[model samples]
Target: MKLHVFDTFAYSKTGKILHFDVLLSERNEVKAHQRAIEWLDSIGEQGATIKPRGCTFCHTVADAPQFADEVARNGYAIYKLEGCPA
Candidate 1:
């Protein structure tokens, strides 16, 4: 599994620095949900809110909800901004 991280920062309308991060990856999978989780974990081993995709098979999971459900409904799991497990 190959992982990638993105250095990012967020701000509020009042110019308040919301958060700064040098996101890192602990793992990578061909699956989209898994990959997204890996991304969130890299920063601090956390979970993230995931948006399901369309027809596309990933090593980690199936295509997505709409499409994936059509084919492998019980194959993959979906979530959005879920906290990481310790």
Candidate 2:
């Protein structure tokens, strides 16, 4: 499967910046942004919003098998790159 990647960044309540990538099977910027926010919320970043310039189309790539299952279940998969809570 091919996945569209959206590089995203959001600031936590403590003002810590979080950087991650949202990967979706379809190429939809709106959905990508929504997923990014949803992920932040799930990680306890309630009410977090992506920076105006934070979410941008990065590239499309072939899916890694591990991510396929997650994409099938969640419609998107997150690749946390930095500033995320372990």
Candidate 3:
């Protein structure tokens, strides 16, 4: 299986910056992309998607704009500032 990392950042309820990341693997890139799409579907604009395992930073993009299409390449999905581990 190929490993993939998805990254993003959002603010906490207390105003602190919360950086989040999640790692997933699938048999191929097609499956990986599908997995990412499913995850995105599970979490709409008003919702947040939490990592089931690996990292546990909790995602909550309350007012941020859509980012997947503009930032991802080769099935990698990313959204936010640099330096977050994925």
lDDT of the candidates, in the order given: 0.32, 0.89, 0.38
In terms of TM-score, the best-performing candidate is 2
Number of backbone-clashing residue pairs for each candidate, in the order shown: 6, 0, 0
Worst 10 residues of 3 by lDDT: 45-54
Which parts of model 2 have CA positions greater than 4 angstroms off?
none
Any residue pairs clashing in model 1, and if so which? Answer: 24-42, 31-60, 48-81, 49-80, 49-81, 50-80
Flag the better candidate by lDDT, 1 or 3. 3
Q: Tell me the tens digit of each residue's lDDT in model 2 across 5-71.
A: 9999998777888999999999888899999988988988997768787988899998578788899
lDDT tens readout by residue for model 3, 1-86: 23344443443334444344433332343443344444444444223333333232233333323434432433434442433333
Error of 1 at 11 (Å): 15
Between candidates 1 and 3, the TM-score winner: 3
lDDT: worst 10-residue window of model 2 = 47-56
The positional error of residue 7 in candidate 3, measured at the CA in angstroms, is: 1.1
Rate residue 76 of model 2 by lDDT. 97
lDDT of 1 by residue, 1-86 (tens): 22222223332334432222221122222444444444445545343333333212323322233433322433323332223233
- Model 2 per-residue lDDT at 41: 85
Shift of residue 39 alpha carbon in model 1, Å: 1.8
Query: What TM-score goes with each of the models?
Result: 0.24, 0.93, 0.29
